[model samples]
Target: MSTAPLVAVPAAAAAVPRHVAIIMDGNGRWAKQRHLPRFAGHKAGVDAVRRVTRAARALGIEALTLYAFSSENWRRPEEEVADLMGLLRIFIRGDIDELVRENVRLRVIGDHSRLAPDLVAMVDAAVARTAANTGPILAIALNYGAQAELAAAARRLAERLAPHEIDEAAIEAELDTRDLPPLDLLIRTSGEHRLSNFLLWQAAYAELLFVDTLWPDFDAEALGAAVAAFGRRQRRYGGL
Candidate 1:
């Protein structure tokens, strides 16, 4: 049986969701179905990113988080990994100016120590360039793993507490997503039905929406449907 809730909210409500998170899945499968290389699907997925970002901004969404690259992706073929990094660099260099023009602020999360120095530099430059934008914030999770993030947060909290300082608030303060709002709607593309360690802590009570469309094929209409579905949800937040 489906575990999804059936709550309803009016369309005119001013309290629309402030954050939307997505797990872009099915890139490799999309490529395989076409007898093309996996990187082609990834390239196409980048185009979807642009479309979704534009759609989110138009919908008055305050923040959008995209699960781009996870720590587990490092286990993939070396050449594919290099190509993904290259694609990221290309996107940063090619899209920053346009993103700034659109008033979008680009923020990245996850461990960057393993990234190539040049790529890291480009990401940093892009973030700095778009820092002053007043529009919707775009957060890309690269080399990110929710489990690792939580473990890291726990370690930091443990370091700060001898014994007396241990508390939920303290642990929350140490989390990497502390500065970000809790997830409002979490969407996963490619028909996947699992969290896959995307945002385990932050998505505790988020509405989950799944679509069978591949990441590369995701567009504005699909995004609109997700928002509309969210509008019909009655978010009790653990209350009646």
Candidate 2:
């Protein structure tokens, strides 16, 4: 699906949001509609990732979180899931050097125990390699679910603190995104209208946008237009 080509922010638009999150949706649907294998869409989705990552950085977004793989995604057909994993491996192998060149810090949030050992190790290696970069962050949400993240954070609090000692701050400190900036704007493509359990905690105050553009079709224009729209919103954080 095509989107607005104009990304030029008007004077009325506010400063760019610092932290942006995206639910990259519609890969399977994009493939199905094109009469191609779903993995074809996923492969193209990789290109979209490259485009969006560069756009986010250029837009001065301090942090960019992408919903790469979800915990629920494992329920898909086993062969498809395997294909997704294979894609991740190839993407990392092919793209990590570019990430380094871009000065983007790589991070992953979610349960690592369920992933393949080699995959986890590879991801860790990539993160470690990019640990020194000071540019905009690129957090990949792999096998991540927000509700599960909340529960795990709570579990960590329980392990170290008495019930009375555990407070909001304690729980917040244990979240995977504890050190990241507050979520500013969240975008979901493919015309999806729900969060699908991605970043439930961090999105508490995020400005939300849903676009009809499929993930594979998303590009700088789509993302810049979303960011510009976010700038026009007057965020009061519940204040009058």
Instruction: Enumerate residue pairs that collide in model 2.
Output: none
- Candidate 1 regions exceeding 4 Å error are 1-15, 162-164
Off by over 4 Å in 2: 1-14
Mark the 10 consecutive residues where model 2 has the least summed lDDT.
1-10
Candidate 2, residue 10: how far the Cα is off, in Å = 6.9
The estimated TM-scores of all candidates read 0.91, 0.93
lDDT of 1: 0.84
Candidate 1 on 1-240: residue-level lDDT in tens? 111123333366554578999999988999999999999999998888878887777677789999988999999999999989988987887788788888888888898667999888889899899998888789999899999998998787777677787776776677666767778999999998999999888888899999999999988778877888888888988999
**lDDT at 41, model 2:** 93
Deviation from native of the Cα of residue 37 in model 1, angstroms: 1.4
TM-score of 2: 0.93
